[model samples]
Target: MRVFAQLFEAIDSSTKTSRKVAAMVDYFDRVSDEEKLFAVALLIGNKPKRPVATTSLREWASALAGIPSWLFEESYYAVGDLGETLTLLMPQQSRPEETPTLKAVFATMTALRKYSPMEQRETLYTFWTTLRGTALFLFNKMLTGSLRVGVSRKLVINALARHLDRDEATVAHQLMGKWDPLTTRFTDLFPQQGTALPHHIPYPFYLAYALDREPADLGDINNWLLEKKLDGIRGQLIRRNGELFIWSRGEDLLTDKFPEFGPLTTLLPDGTVIDGEIIPWKDGHPLPFARMQTRIGRKNLSAKMLQEVPLVMVCFDLLEYEGRDIRHEPLLIRRAQLAALIDNPALQRILLRSEEMAFPDWQAAADFRERARQFHCEGLMLKQWQSAYGVGRRKGDWWKWKADPFSIDAVMIYAQSGHGRRANLYTDYTFAVWDGDTLVPFAKAYSGLTDTEIKSLDRWIKQNTVEKFGPVRRVKPVHVFEIGFEGVQASNRHKSGVALRFPRMLRWRLDKTAAEANTKDDLLDLLRLYGQ
Candidate 1:
């Protein structure tokens, strides 16, 4: 346990990717077989390998070489993490006085090997029985890859520096060295100060925090820089010390996902990172989100997927340029620097040219977003020119001024039980539109209603069930709710040849009659924007 803690401390210090990887490989090479099993599980994080499904101890144990899921469930119910469970299961003397940190556990776990099914189950059970209180909670969070300490990866980098008495850049290098996160150790690969590390490019640092009310009035739309709110992944392209790193908003490295932008490496200003959105675009407009979904996580994509969902980098904000860190600079300053950095808009791949557009009023911005469906856009992004880069949440500096959703008062025709907390309640719903004389099922949306509303609806579903299709309960089409969506697209997969983007229930339209529900023509109008 102490050894694990020490390794985590070392991994914490490592900023360079090489150092982290080296540490992980070294640590994994040394642990005992029993310890190795738990270590591997820990490396994979405390979360179960997949979504929690119905399982018995014998069945699960058999699958994991005879280690029962009960063991893990017990440990998770106890200490929360498998490591702590191991600690609890071990003899008191074997349990180290000091608990190891998460990073140490990560390093220790990565160096280990695949455990037998039985040993894995035993380890899991022991882990649960031993872990307790806050430790258990943190362990559970780690299992889900969410340490939720309000800590960002950058903040972790800072923590590493503080732990190792090293500079940030040195530590950053150690951090970025490997692709396999499980095996990287931070301590052994810690870089010395002033090391010729990878140069990081300037990327926009996005900050969005929800406000109780509007943050700023914008005076008129004229003062704001408004651009279409694209429905795609946000990308941060960084070029530091000549090495290129492109990251998603979720901080996942995505350089390999879009090869078309790879050539832009030569044109990019070194030691810079810029923020942008990566969308599927061809010819002159944006592609559907489903198109880009095809090529997202593949290490090597099929040629069909590549041609089907080609990518475009829609550059938004610039954070770093040349050698200067412009995150501290105002948004207006960053815009000017970004403009000067990319001299050719015509050649740039789908850059969000908000500066050139006349945003002179919020209404104009809203109007543009309203018509954005024509351009296959989600909505609009309204940014304050004077704001500086701030991490996490909506600050006053930026706002996503998306158009109001495409709403329809629809009748709830079916209901199904939800998972986890709502496992007993019929919360999932299948909504329909009154087409001609029949209620044709057009969508199934389960979210957007409150727990109270769900409970009420749950009772109604049970009392009104006309028929049951396994877990799904067919209900009378008497309830009406307003459904909201980002965009509508035509699809042969459905009866209406219409699919809603980001569909969610806004409110129960009890005030509206079934006859007041949106017509099939409304769906057709929106789908026409997709050229179907």
Candidate 2:
């Protein structure tokens, strides 16, 4: 536990990628095989279920610190983090003579879930006394299921690749699919010899970066393959060993969740994997993303719900064919094969080819992009015809040219402290639009501001606070910001009778006043234009 905590601190304290990778590599080299497997899993977002309730922990910590609950709440609000607040409030203690291993800690957490409340409190008290400083903070974070660090999954994969003398892509692919880190050995994950991978495992998705320059800047139009960027879940549909599996880009096994595509197991040949978007389709058009959300997180799909929000896999790329990996082949050849494979009438029932756009030049491409919203698509994807299907995100091969977001000037009416690095600053804000003489909260945004701008606004927020509501402060509506969002829809759950998708602050409109902000009527107009 101490070593893992040290690794966390080393990675968090440094901003350089090389330093972080070195720290991870050194840690991985020193740990046991089981410990290494668990470490990799934790770093790559496979955290265990939280073992204790946050309210119980807060109560226990306050009692141990000899402080009242209200005082603890105030400290938590000021700190902007529950784990940090608990760690600081507890009395300092000496380090244990023998620190527990990471595996032992995980075991204790698993046991605590079955323990009674009193037993759980006693175990936590023992942990608080033995662990100190960063170790204690990390323990609290794990208990709260908020163990986040400054490193990316790619950095960890790079470190593993360096430590094992393996290709980075190979290391990434080995980490894909569902595997129990507690039982699996590190060697089992990355074998020294050639070993067969699980039949259900999927290849790492190829992501595209946003287009920052003009389409003409990318050279000849014929060199790029254009397809509409559908606003749906990006998934890999695999037909392996007479079984169909649908895995999301997040590495979730969603075969059971999307049983509508089960026919592909018989229709598609064995050892075939296709990358596509799982969209909610009906009446020969894509449904709104909001409609798709209804089917998400639902384990048991009713017949009515399935009928209302029908699904289809819009395939774009072929990763494997005839039980052989063909990611190195040029995309044009792969597309030709994918088209031929998906041409059958039975396969066409649940699968549709992502039609490529035929454009003479950049101007015609832009015109097609403008029609993306009409088809419920996000934008157009431009892929190099001759580029290979690479792992993770790579530049120069593919780009996503999205339509401009809907923008509106709104007033900042509520402010809250941020988490992690921005914990001490008022970085989160709720914006409102005019409803007659009233300012109705419409959207909340926390990004797109420079560090200097955040600091300046933090100072302003501290001075202009009107009222306090626990962690949130009802600030005076004096500041205006231009908020940008991809789409808008009517929502009865929101007080404004609408909701914004992917809303963020575009810029601080310092010249505008609260009264000059947009109105609820304007939001309704947007809903009428864009809402399904």
Query: Per-residue error at 497 for model 1, in Å?
Result: 4.3
Model 2 residue pairs with clashes: none
Off by over 4 Å in 1: 1-48, 51-204, 209-216, 220-223, 297-309, 344-355, 359-363, 419-425, 435-438, 466-471, 491-497, 512-522, 530-532
TM-score of 1: 0.67
Instruction: For candidate 1, write residues 13-127 as lDDT tens digits.
Output: 7666556545555555576433433443344333223212224332442343334565555543334233334333433333323444445444433322255545545554444
The TM-scores of all predictions, comma-separated, are 0.67, 0.98
| Model 1 lowest lDDT segment of ten | 45-54
All-Cα superposition RMSD per candidate: 9.0, 1.3
Alpha-carbon lDDT, every model: 0.61, 0.90
